[model samples]
Target: MTDPGAYPNPGQHPTPHEQPPRTRRRRWPWLVIGVPVLLFGACGVAVVTSVAGGNDTTVTPGPAAGDTDGGAPDRGPDFPGKLDHDTAAAAGATITRDELAYTVSPLEAVDTVLGSYLCSTVTIDNVGTTQNDFNGYTDWSLQDTGGAIRDATFGPDRPMLNSGQIAPGGRATGSVCFDDRTGATPGTYVVLFEDTFSLSTDRLAWINAL
Candidate 1:
């Protein structure tokens, strides 16, 4: 039998040097994921707003060709030096100029072209004592207002101006025709008659504007 005081000793109680079990702190992982997700969502909203704002602008186009005058017909003055067919020869006395004589009939439009065909009578008078050879075609060209030259083409229906020589104090006459279907615009066109086809002298006789 043991003593009661010795069996249950008070020295067995917790001392000041011993400590209770400490609770470990729980780590909060949601803060790390929530910050990155919020930043990415803000950037996504900004990109969508920028793309939606760009689609509201408008664009325009330019005009087509030949719209310089708003598709309107060219309205200008008639060509000069026009004469009646029957009165052309009778009026020669008044039509005669310095050296050569010319009578241009009014421009005639056979097709959509304003002045498609032009007929004229060219008379060369040898004023000098020597004989003069009057050349044609190569010495003649139709010059437009834009400084473009139109050459001649001989067809079954198209007649070329007769070219020949004239004696002293004598005269020669021939028919002149111009077809402006090709390379012709709505503007003034003049007949240029060069004395010589060579480059030596570019002596020209303008037959007025049409």
Candidate 2:
């Protein structure tokens, strides 16, 4: 009673093997929006290469400890001849050449009448920037230890490191004498200074003992 041409009724039109399969355009929404935009563009190019390698890191800083040349103030190491008592320069030590600094003080025998004088108390200091000219008799001296050098004299009444001119930061005490006619015992002696007419030959020594 109900077989109207084996089921193709209700205004139908599905012919070609009764089709029903053509749905393949879903590439998971471009892999979920291209894997988070390629992991947020590789974490924004690794945060701009870690902030351009932390602004090209750099530090640099060295020389300073008795500095030299560029910072000048280490005129040590040079004990030429006969300077015992552990390489001279000690009685209140403070050498610094060319730019001048000196500082002796500590060798006071006295005994007058052209004999055991020794004296001391120098000072100098013109840390350098210009004017510098000391000459306690051509820049002090008093070697001994059998090397003989003695030279600084004329201490009219003491206070006399004469031949001045020491501006930049100026300073200049005095008293130098030297002539220790071998009454020996100021720790053998060694208070030289020599910087003659400068071109820098630097000499400074000072172990006239404690």
TM-score per prediction, in order, is 0.41, 0.25
lDDT of candidate 2 over 122-144, digit per residue (tens): 88788779997787788677776
Q: Model 1 off-target regions past 4 Å? A: 1-116, 155-160, 182-186, 197-199
lDDT of 1 by residue, 151-180 (tens): 643322434456777777887665555666
Worst 10 residues of 2 by lDDT: 56-65
Segments of candidate 2 deviating more than 4 angstroms: 1-100, 103-123, 126-143, 147-156, 160-168, 183-189, 192-210
Q: Which residue pairs in candidate 1 collide?
A: none
lDDT score, residue 68, model 2? 48
Candidate 1 global CA lDDT score:
0.46
After superposition on all CA atoms, what RMSD does each candidate show versus the true structure? 29.0, 21.3
Error of 2 at 118 (Å): 5.8
| TM-score attained by model 1 | 0.41
